[model samples]
Target: MASTVLIFSASLIALFLFSLTGVNANAGSNVFSMQSYGARGDGLHDDTKALRDAWAAACSSAKPAVLLIPKGKKYLNRHTILSGPCKSNIVLMSNLMASPKRSDWSKETIRHWILISGVTSLTITGGGTIDGNGKIWWQNSCKTNSNLPCTEAPMALTLHACKNLKVEDLKVVNSQQIQISVEDCTDVKMSPVSITAPETSPNTDDIHITRSRDVQVMDCTIKTGDDCMSIQDRTENLHVNNMVCGPRHGISIGSLGDHNSEAHVSNVTVDNGRLYGTTNGARIKTWQGGKGSAKNIVFQNMKSAVEVSDVLFKNIRGTSASEEAIMLHCSSSVPCHGITLEYVKLTVKGGSNDVRSTCQNAEWKKSGSVSPQPCSFKN
Candidate 1:
């Protein structure tokens, strides 16, 4: 598994470097500034319409386009969707903030704030901040403070049905819900990104990848209230490397096959992860009575089980917030198989060195110096 990941990482890094170089070439091409379209950049006015117009002009361009949101400006926006099957490659250098007022949102736009959909060969960079202004949303969320009705909140940024996408060198903070969502996309690469939110903030997952393929999330720093990165159903060929996750739930595989539905995910790899004081180290969670296969997953340092099989966790070293540092709760009806844990060492945070492992209805193999012991199936 290590050898395979090394090779794949090498090639994927090369490919992304090449594509990102091409994407940066647009810096010399046409520029469509948001301020030119009547935006104030004051951090108070609604800049949604101006941004929409800028996106329209950029998308319609015959040559590569650059939608520039110049530095040091904090333009406030409402639910904004930049949708396209544009004529050429598009670059969105984003530096913006979202309105904090919950009433400004409606049922139609509550799920997404800055949505970039149906665009191909898109690149988003520009070392700026995307503030979700989530103080109001967090106050209203049922998860944090009870007595409020549970309602859907907006994800700070979403990329839907996009191909050949590259998002890097950005700071995403205080998202109302999930920080960054990659859905139904292909050939996506995100690297050297920072995602942050209060540890008490509700459901602010750093990154969520679902129904996507060939996606790579590398060299990211994440501190959030939810899973640092959640890999959901129908995602394949996904790679996560050199991630720093803490003060949150660790990397998760699935809450898949929910409500007795069938789902399949395969070819996932997570490598060189550093998780500190997290609720779980490597997790794979599948609902009871759910059907589907989650297979060929190699976590060089992670867990989840939707009929999970052929999964490996290697070289994982971290401090677990709970006593059960390693937990594998596979479904009884569809037990997990071919699971392996290698060189895993996890200790409880600020407590005795008596951490434990729990394995149920799963078949596993262990190799090398595992602390708190390793799981072995009962014959």
Candidate 2:
């Protein structure tokens, strides 16, 4: 604990020193305040333009700039972008307030309400909350009502093609779909954050990472309807630790091999996870008739996909009320192979007394007290 405090203190000191330097491209930090450019922050009228202007100035600034959204303020916005290849390092500190509403977003691209992209060496730190007003979207979702046509809803926050990114101390709630998504990026870190939504809110995963590499997720609490963390195709070298998940699906890897499409996902590690009131403890699900290699995945949830392969799970302890405590529903044609388990203990919840492991064409080298055991039978 002392060492952690010292490290944090040192980081603060370094940042403070950096802030005190004169504004220059290579040496100092500048501030671009949203209020100075005319942000109402009243939560009524849209402050999109003001925030955009602040972002524009910061993006083109000659020095490292802080695009600051002050505390105790609620900024309303429509679809927004903070794209960059700025002259120097950039910091985005905002209280992401509200997302723009839409009747139907079926025709739009996956552009989030707040999209951050094309930036290198960026820091995102804030103490404010992002309210995703997902009530209407949830009511109209096709997950519970199959009669309605399936359509794509926008994410609350998205980081696209960003390298060396840091997301710290943020609260995201009630997203229409995926709360936070990172795609096509590298060297990203996220920690000490909370993401939440109602258990009945469909398709609202806490964090979804796709086609990204060298990412770290730590000390996060996620309570949502879908997977706490969903790992998709082309994602490699990922690590998640000190995670708390509840009232949702546990950490999951892929519904890969979709449409008989080939996918590659590898090198993932999930350590020290706590799951409660979830549907599945740890899961790997894939679709049939698809071809690809999904090797070297380390750990955890639910969602549909094509193929699954090579993964390791270790040191995961939790309670599961669901009958299928650990689910490894793999494809028959391309059966899951090279799975490894160690130090995983999941006890049955409630008084039912029947908690089983379900494995369909799943294989793993097992160790420790993994409930229902590994690769033994399918329920």
Best by lDDT: 1
lDDT of 1 by residue, 1-379 (tens): 0111111111000001112333465345788888899988888899889989999999999899888877667889999999999999988875789997888999988999899999999988867789998879999999977888999999999999999999878789999999999999999999889988898999998899999999999999998888898889999999999987776577788877888888788999988876655766566778778888889988784222234678888999889998888888876545778888788889999856989888777788777777776466432
Candidate 1 displacement at residue 166 in angstroms: 0.3
213-268: candidate 2 lDDT, tens digit per residue: 99999999998889888888989999998887776577777777778877778998
TM-score of each: 0.74, 0.71
Native-vs-model 2 lDDT? 0.74
The candidate that wins on TM-score is 1
lDDT of 1 at 371: 77
lDDT of 2 at 309: 53
Candidate 2: stretches off by over 4 Å: 1-27, 103-106, 109-111, 300-379
Residue pairs in clash, model 1: 282-302, 282-303, 283-303, 283-304, 284-303, 284-304, 284-305, 285-304
Worst ten-residue run, lDDT, model 2?
7-16
Candidate 2 TM-score, true structure as reference: 0.71
Q: Name model 1 segments beyond 4 Å from true.
A: 1-28, 301-379
